[model samples]
Target: MPVPSAPGGAAGPATPPAPHITRRGLALAGLATAQFMVVLDSSIVNVALPSIRRGLDLTPAQLSWVVDGYLVAFAGLLLLGGRLADVFGRRAVLLGGLTAFAAASALCALAPNGPVLVGARIAQGAAGAVMAPAALSIVMTLFPDGPDRARALGVWGGVSGAGGIAGVLLGGVLSQTLGWPWIFVINVPVALAVGAVVLVSVRPFPAAGGSFDIAGAVTVTLAMAGLALGVVMGSDAGWTAPVTPAALVLGLAALAAFVALERRAARPLVPLRVLARPRLAVANTIMLLLGATAAGLFYFLPQYQQNVLGMSPLTTSLTQLPIALTITAGGLLAPRVAAVLGVRLALTTALAWLAVGLAWLARADPHARFLDGLLGPFLLIGAGLGTAFVYVTTLAVAGSAPGETGLVSGLVNTARQMGGAVGLAALVALATATGTPAGTGTPAGHQPNLTAAFLGAAALAATALLLSLTSALHHPAPTAASPLLPGQRTST
Candidate 1:
């Protein structure tokens, strides 16, 4: 957990990146844009799912793959992506990912059928898994710990939260007016532009050279992919389905194998010691819980607006604008709160706020008004989501050893993505069970008890809130040049 004490803390084998980073502003812009694009693509196609089905003549299962394919690939390969950055150089991996992502997006735009589009989406996700960690590592490199890093992360968090909302809005517009292809087409130009800016602005950091752990990589990647696929299948095909349990069992077996292999591997894909750190463990656990809550909220809230309230897709997007804006505002404000309360307390407060919001949302009904029942809760939930994103990321990344930011970044991202898959699947089941009448099948026009789902999400936030209170998460107060704020000292 030892960190460097100055700007551009540590480099692997190449030249120190700080001296070469003359364009800090531009570098941040490019890195943040890359992250925004990655997050945007995660949800951009949701509104367009129906359109895609009609255009491609896709079956229900195939249509689901268009989304699940991306999630599974992105979640599964994130750890590998981070490890690759550590070994192959962050800039190289980042540029490669951007190039691959752009090409995949282009393929998606031009896809002739459902299978091709699904393949393209998976390619896009794999590329994104590479791009995201590298981009975040560079951001850590550009700004040393303290107020500068905090602010940088806030901007990053803002864009990330906003991207999810913006995707829904943009998809509705583009799919309706232009076509489903336009959604993917837009990414091509954006990815290219971001890559161009990054190429000019960011410096190449040295790679931490070592022999690759092939066995560890294979096992862990398979574990994550299996787990993600299992959750997706359970959501789509019910938990009683044979493949669902089979996939979950396989994933658990692979994960156990991975742990055993890492214990003996000389060059491990992920060092066991790092993950065993008390601070890292606590931070990631809480992040997983928070991620689960946030993902479920985003997935179900729109359905409530559209199905229960009979709002148009565009109207649903518009109604959610306040949530996006508030999330941004909260992210921007998080640094100040952390400066005053320290990372742990700030994160704890954010989770508490989110729990309150979700609990209120559980009270919503079909006749509830937007302003009275939804907007009030949205404001609280959005702010909490934004604030927690900043603090949790800062907490996890702040204490990372030099040259290992990519690995730590990947772990946290993996936690969130995996949590999302689990949360969505579990909530779907909970809602289904609660809403269905005894012995009678769910009839058309009978939506699931989304309120119960909201309550479940609230419980998740509350659990995270409790976890954040753990002594492991405690740290000293921040000040100018304080190592606790991201320098030589471990923040956790």
Candidate 2:
């Protein structure tokens, strides 16, 4: 539409190209901010759970629902949400999602009962599911497959993860100083501010126009909701409870139906071919384990520090600064490690690091000190989380077809959310069974309960490590013609 470049690649030797690149960079900043806020919600409420429980008269199990409920809706709707972004336009979807999320946060803040708070959390999660993939898809749309895209993703991934750890620390300060309601109230201003920036900076992406898959969306959403409910209630209501079995059966049946529908749908929500890829399958499984273990550890760690150790919320939050910093460092180094060691080897090493950290924490004694007992494990976990998230996400979308990027992003995130929901449910049950639900008991009894949960998380990491080793045996032979994984600096 404009003049061609002159001989020296100057734009007609007078007018420069439109400031498209700068616009893209600005857009990336807006998207990354939205992503950071979405991820922060997943953990920010954790430290506030005790305050909410006291204010609203919530049981320990009900408190778990506040976090898990968000996860359930997010995981369930992610695929459909991604598709909708393609249909509705990325900027439109993201703005809409941010609006909904902000409103939900207000709802959560104003709720006087546990049920209302949990419901609001679910609304926030669903909106986040829409926002996250749409935001990332915008990244892919704006940045070409090169160093630019890679760098943007690196910043995106790092900020997304740092939000999770930072939430624990921030939650403590807000709950301690401003009261628990401030945690949710804080989201309103941030979300609105980010939305305003995005509106002004980011242009709308053309919709990946298609007929919506109504049946697929409905069934899968129902399946994930049922599964999350079953998992949560399975522990609380006992495995043999009639409702638990019914929910489990209903969830599985709906899942089967969703699969059957997808196989025949004219425009499927998730293509079977994508799911069948061997490398993607393994990578997602590893992500699931990593997500689950991390969620479990975060869930219990604060309870131990506050309940057993009698630490104030501010002090407890400060303890996690080391984790946040190390995760940032780990993210910076992940690309280099992947270039040198290959994806499988690098991921395995990261998993091993996580396992070591968890095992170290598992050895805690009844009267342990934080510096001697917890700091080392937190460092290891942060490093592992930082590196694993980068590489695993790269692997998940490595070979995707052009239009399928949003779908894969949604699937990858769904794995993490589902893993967190299920893992937290299981660990919550374990802690209850071990002793009085995350050490809400005598000081002497607290350490053992937390130790059991930490060991369980360690075991999950080890399992992922074992899977990574098995996958290494099946690596394809590298050749001169082989393609490097997407955006990797090398062919390793």
Candidate 3:
């Protein structure tokens, strides 16, 4: 089969290429698998946290590190990874990242101590940063048409949305039946298999030549790590702690330095011009808020199930099916909704749904029933999240130059990860500060803290809604001539 030419005839192949299982379809598959793995890792360890804590003899802070390590590395390195993919070949970087991720997963499964486990988690996250951008770039390159790309993205979004819920369910089942290690162990074979598929199916695209921005990379990485660590530690140590204040200060300083460096660097990690676009900037802000709100809700929901509802880990995981299934359903339906309602209308509606869902969750009590109180809210949350993801993602990627697609995608995803880390930390801090005892393994008192967390999440969702509304009103719809990276290319 002949390879399809890239946009503007800057490629090595001809048009009307013979379809061998359609390049678009295969590209979508590869991207979806990457997204699934990344999303799955996010919460897969939650159900096994107790087992891990017991087996590793971890303190609460150490246990938190198991999750935090991954977020820090993944979020910190994402921009660099995306630039690397653009400089090198996306396929090469993707396969390498997959191999590294598989090895790291194996190491995690074999870890004998908390430190080792945390280190392995960090390696896995770094590999994820590399893999994610390459995967999205493959999709962007393969599906150049608007309609085709939209459809492919809907499937991609569905996989990502479903993967989060599936992680909890799979983790619960694996931990109960096999052991916590299996949760990590399972990634090895899956990663290897996906690596093989990516190697075989993805065609080589031309590399965009550029030197890595080492200074920008270092500063941004430190900034992200500092910010994430500050929030995570603040939850346990109190916001007034010297360590928390120091971390926040250091993070802010580093970020400011990064901005200054980018303004001067010949090849910046993230071009400052890209950030100048109102639509992209606003969209990313909304993405960050939505991410934080979603993570906060997912993190605490299991606590309510296990502590308040008296559910087993397995049952708690099962109860999240309403969220998983609805997210998948909504993701699959998002493109159609976007087509019918337009991006602005769809986005506004989704945000409204999220607000309502969060408010409903805030009303939960110790006596709340699953069907009446939890199920509907979960379903609504999932649906709203699913729809919002499509719009936000589309806006993030829509008008970028070909060379900058990976960077744009990586930045958007990085925002999501950072948001999740900060959001989770903030909610936990609120629970701790309000002196609302998060039930010492009891039923009655646990619900109030969780409810408070959900209320905080609602406020975050409202913030996102406000931003989305402003973006819709002020920014015009992006056209094909617009650069994918913000301000990187001007309208023709």
Candidate 4:
């Protein structure tokens, strides 16, 4: 029998709610494993692109589809997935998504051609969209509703943050030692295992009774799809392309309508009050900036290392190992850092690292030494990115009402996805705008090319920093926006 407790109690096992996963050790393992598999798929296929292309007889454009398809579907439907998890039941939806994800992985592994692979990846990404937010929301329920949750989130961030880098490493090992298909095949067993664990370990979440906002779901899904399409197509088709502007307008209009409709809906997919919270708002905005600048950082750095500095692809990939490790280290350090330097200062310092690091990288000369020139900024970037992502994510979810976890989680994630697409697209355009002259020296042309992009990324980080200098990040006492830190107590 369930132990009856006061609403919003802050005790150990019943932090906010009684999590059947015990609100402790083994449950966290289940959540983290599920998180890893969902996040790993985002980048696992990148290293296998060449092999996939040859094996599937895919055109460059078709190969691009393999990635873009997944991204669009994942980013577009995240909020819907989150809402479903919260409204229906987290455990049920999570298990369902894991099952679908494993099945999709199987389809991807066995795909015979480009179309099949693209379709399977899209399905896989959609399943991930469902799984990611639900798993995260469950994390919220698993820890005590105070400093414990904050610290646990740090661990969660470390595992989640490392997924992309881990994918690159794993993809290389699996694809080379086995085949390109192994990248997806590996997920099948992992997802199945995660699913089995959740089923056996987790107690069912009661459906939060609510009227289905079917109309709201449709509008937002279309809105996100349109916006993602605009950004994704803007690079290839030109920003002025008919499809791009049309999609943008459609998305913006639908978004506006969705907001207006939500304000009046009996049960909105996302409540308007949640959007009104300053801390949540700024946190998600910072998350967007983090994702954008990070996209530019990763997109350009490896190119500079290989093309300008003359390093082997294998060597360049291996070099990033330090960055990946540093990222995980930073994630683990975030709660401690936030404890010492208040959240705002910590976040500001993290952004400063990005601005300063990227700005430093802009001065990279053609003959620059790897250890002295690149390693510092890479470490700084890795740590800064690690810290920023963890803190921003924590703040993003800090002040959620009982049933709003999935909504907020989805919102922050959607911001990250869209930001990355937009950031990388804009940077690519800037890099390509001034085409390399036929006789330009490698040093002269490549140096400036990479420098300009790095400087732009620095400027973007700086802008975000400037924007971050506000009251939202500061909380001498926990506000309704953020009352879940160690010393903090939840107010009902």
Clashes of each: 0, 0, 7, 1
Global lDDT of each candidate: 0.73, 0.73, 0.72, 0.69
lDDT string for model 1 (38-127, tens) is: 878876776666567668976444554676567666766766676677788889999999999999999999999998998999899889
- lDDT tens readout by residue for model 2, 9-69: 0001111113322466666778888888887887687777666877897765677788877
Per-residue CA lDDT of model 4 for 1-492, tens digit only, reads 000001111111224545466435666777788878776776666556656766787643355557656655676566667667767888898899999999999999999988899899879878877887778777776666678787777667657666757775776677667888999999988888887777777788877755567677668766765775665557546789899899889989988988889999987766788777887778777877776677666656655776677764455566777777777778667777877776667778888997898898889898988789888988877787777776676666675665554466567767776566556555654554433543566433322256777887888888888867877755333446544444322111
Q: Rank the candidates by TM-score, best first.
A: 2, 3, 1, 4
Tens-place lDDT digits, model 3, residues 1-492: 000001111111222223322455665676688768877887787767766866787744566568767876777777777677778877788888899999999999999999999999989888988887677666755665567767876677567766777797997798878888999998988888887777667666668776888799779777876776687667667778999989898889999999999999997877889877787788788888887787677666765666666666787778777777777677667777777676667787889898899899889887788888788888788889877876776777776675555456556766777676666666766755553455566433322366778889999988988887774433554556543222322111
TM-score of 2: 0.86
Model 3 residue 2 CA deviation (Å) reads 36
Model 1 spans with C-alpha error above 4 angstroms: 1-32, 46-68, 89-91, 107-118, 136-165, 196-209, 235-240, 340-342, 395-409, 432-449, 475-492
Q: What is the lDDT of residue 361 in candidate 4?
A: 86
TM-score of each: 0.80, 0.86, 0.83, 0.78
TM-score of 1: 0.80
Model 2 lDDT-worst window of ten: 1-10
Model 3 misplaced regions, further than 4 Å: 1-32, 50-61, 139-158, 198-209, 396-407, 435-448, 471-473, 480-492
Q: Distance (Å) between predicted and true CA of 410, model 2?
A: 3.6
